[model samples]
Target: MLLIEALTTGGAQRQLLNLAVQLGGRGHRVSVVVYHLADYNHRDHFRGEFERAGVPVTDVPVMAPWRRLWAVRRTVRAAGPDVVIAFLRRPGLLAELTALPARRFALIVSERTGKEGGRDMKDLTRFQLHRLADAVVANSAHLEHYVRTAAPWLRTRLRQITNSVDLDHFRPAGAPPPPHPGLRILAIGRFRPEKNFLALAAALRILRTTEPALDVTVDWYGNNFFLGQQPTGRSRPYLELLDVLRETGLEDAFRVHPPVGDVVALYQKADVLCLPSRYESLPNVVCEALACGLPVLASAVSDNDRLVRDGENGFLFDPHEPRSIAEAIRRFAALSADERAAMGRTGRRLAEELLSPATAAVRWADLVEQVVEARRAAW
Candidate 1:
C-alpha cells in the first residue's frame, strides 16, 4: 500500500499503519511510502513496528510537486507492488500521475473524508483522481453514496468498508466502569474548523443555561492540526472557538487538553461522545468510542445517521445548528444512568456486529487478494 502520510497519530495515519501491519502478518508484502519524514509525531515508532513485522518502508521526501511525483514513480518502480492504494487527495493525485507508467499495478484510491469538508481541497482533486484508480474505497455507505453521486463514472468500483476497532484491545475488561458525573460530555478530534468545535462549544453553552450548575464538563483532547503550518486559519479556528466560549461565558467550564495518547480511556470516562464534524466519511473515533461502550451524539451527516439511530443507539443533530446539538445534549442529560447505559449497550452491540478490526482486516485482505490475482492474470 502506498499511503501518503506516515504519521501514526492521526485517524487515517493510524488506520494505514494498522492495515499495513495486519496485511504484512498475513504473508502479503506491504510497503508504505510516505510523503515526507518530517511530518509525523510517531515516525520512529511506526518505523520500528513495521520493521519488526517485516513490512518495508520508504520515505519519499516532499521536494517539489513534480519531484514528489517522480519520487512516487520511482518508488512504485522499485517496489513493483501488485496493488497501490493512495490515502487522501493530494497523494491520490500524485499516485494517479505516477502510476500510469506502472500500468500492471492495480491502483486503489481511498477517501477518508465525506462530502465537502472544512479542510477539503477547493479544486476537488479527489474527483479528478477518481479516473486513475481501478477501485475506490469509501469508508462508509453514506460516503459511497456521496462519491458515486458526485462522480458517477466510477460507481462500479465504489465500495463501503467502515473503519475498524481491535475488539480485544478496546473491549470491556469487566473492570468496573468509571462513574461519570451528570451532564459529562466528551468530543475528540483535532480542534479544527472542520470538526466544528465552535458549534460544539456553543451547544454546550446552551446546555449550561438550561440547567445552571449542570456540572457539565466537556473534556476535549486534541491539538490544532494546522498549528505553525503553511496553511493559514489554523489558529483562527481555535481563536474563534475560544471567542465562542468567552461569549457564552462558559470559558471556565471547558477543559481543553493537548492531544493525549490513549483516547479509549477518555471515552470510558465520559457519559456521551459528541462528534459535531462538518463532514466525514466515517470517523474512527466514533467507532472506537462505541466499542468502548459510549453512546454518541454526532451530527446528522454522512454515515452518522447510519451509525447512530436517533434516540436508539445514540442521537444525531444538525452540525451547523447549535440549537439542534444543544437539544441532543439536553436530552442525553435527562436520561437516567440506566437509560444512558442501555443506549451505550446498543452502540456497543452495533459496533461488534459491524466494526471489529478482525472483520475489517479480512475484508481488506480479500480485496487485496483479488487485486493481486487480477494483476497476476494480466501478466
Candidate 2:
C-alpha cells in the first residue's frame, strides 16, 4: 500500500502517482490511501488516472486526529499489503504508528524534502520515529543527509531512489519555435515562497532596468497550489506573487498560466527553462525540461548540481539573490544558437542517464523486497 496525504497536483504528488502507476505496470498489486480530510473533493486530481491504471484508491477522510488514525488503520488492514510505504511527513508518522505489535507488514517511509531549522524538535521527533520503519527512503542525497544528521541510527536503513521523469512522454520535439521579440523562458511549479517567484520578479526588474535592449519574456505554468485553494480572508500566495510582479512593473514580461496536463508542449515552446526555487530535493519540472531537450537555468540547491552541469547543459544561480538570477539569465542569453542547442542535447543525455522511470521503479521494488525479507528473517 502507498500512503500519501492526497492526490493533489504538486511535485511530490506527481512523483508518487508516477511511481504507483509504474509499479502497477510491473505486475505489482498496489493501492493508494489518501487521508487528507479538508477539501477532499478539490484535491483528488489524479483519481481518474489511478482508476485508469486499475489501482484501487481508498480515502480515510476524517478530521479528528484520533479518528484519522483509526481510519488509516482500517484502510491498511483492508489492503493487507506485504509492505506499507508512506510518502511525506504526516503519512510517515502514521505508517510508523501502524507498525504496532498487531501489525504484520513491513513499513517503509519516504521523505522527499527537508527545510530550515534543522535542529527543530518537531523535525527531530519525526526522524526518531523512523526507528519503527523497516527502511527510510529519501529521493535526494541531501534528504538522506538530513535524516542521518537528525538520527544517526537511520544510516543502516536509509535508501536513495532519486527522482525520475518519463522519457517517452517528455521527448525532444522539432526545432523550437522562434521567439516573437526575444528569448522565451519557462518556469513551472506551484506558487509558494520556496518556489521563489517573488525573487524571480525582482530579477525581472533587474533585467528590465539593466538590459533594456533584451526583450525577453517569462512564462510561468502553475496552478498556485502552494497554499492550496484559498478560503475567505486568507492570504493567497499566488495573488501575493502577482502583486509583486505589478510592483516590479514586469507583469507584462512575466506571464502566469494554468497548469497543463501535457507539460511537454510547454517545454517545447520555450527557449530555456528557469527554476528559481529556494528549496527542492530533485524538482520534477527540471527533469521534464531536460527530457524535452529544453536548456535550463535552475537554483543551485540539493541534487540540482548532479542534474544540471553548469554552463554545459544549464546554468545554476543562488536563488536568494535576484541579481544572481538575472546574471545567470544573461549568461544563458550570451550563448550562440549552436551553443544552446548543444546544451539541450547534453541535457537530453543527462535525463536519459538520471531520470528513467522504469529504472527508478525497479530500484524501489528491490528495496521493498529487501526490507520484507529482512523482516521475515527476523520473524
- For 12-57, candidate 2 gives per-residue lDDT tens digits of 8778878888778788788899988465223676777788888889
* Model 1 global lDDT (CA atoms, 0 to 1): 0.75
Structure candidate 2, residue pairs in collision: none
Instruction: Say which candidate scores most in TM-score.
Output: 2
Clash pairs, model 1 backbone: 114-280, 114-281
TM-score of each: 0.88, 0.93
Query: Candidate 1: misplaced stretches above 4 Å?
Result: 37-56, 117-125, 178-180, 226-233
Give the alpha carbon lDDT tens digit for every residue of 1-379 in model 1: 6667555456776677678867776787788888763442333334665676676777877477777778878887777778898887776777888767548888888877765643246534667667777788888887777777777777887877778877666754365466756677888877667898888887777776787756777878776544244323445676677777777787777767666656777777778888999888788888888888889999988788767889987889999999998888888888888898888888889889988777788888888888768777877
- lDDT of every model, 2 decimals: 0.75, 0.84
Candidate 1 local lDDT, residue 120: 48
Instruction: Give the C-alpha lDDT of model 2.
Output: 0.84
The deviation in Å at residue 193 for candidate 2 is: 1.2
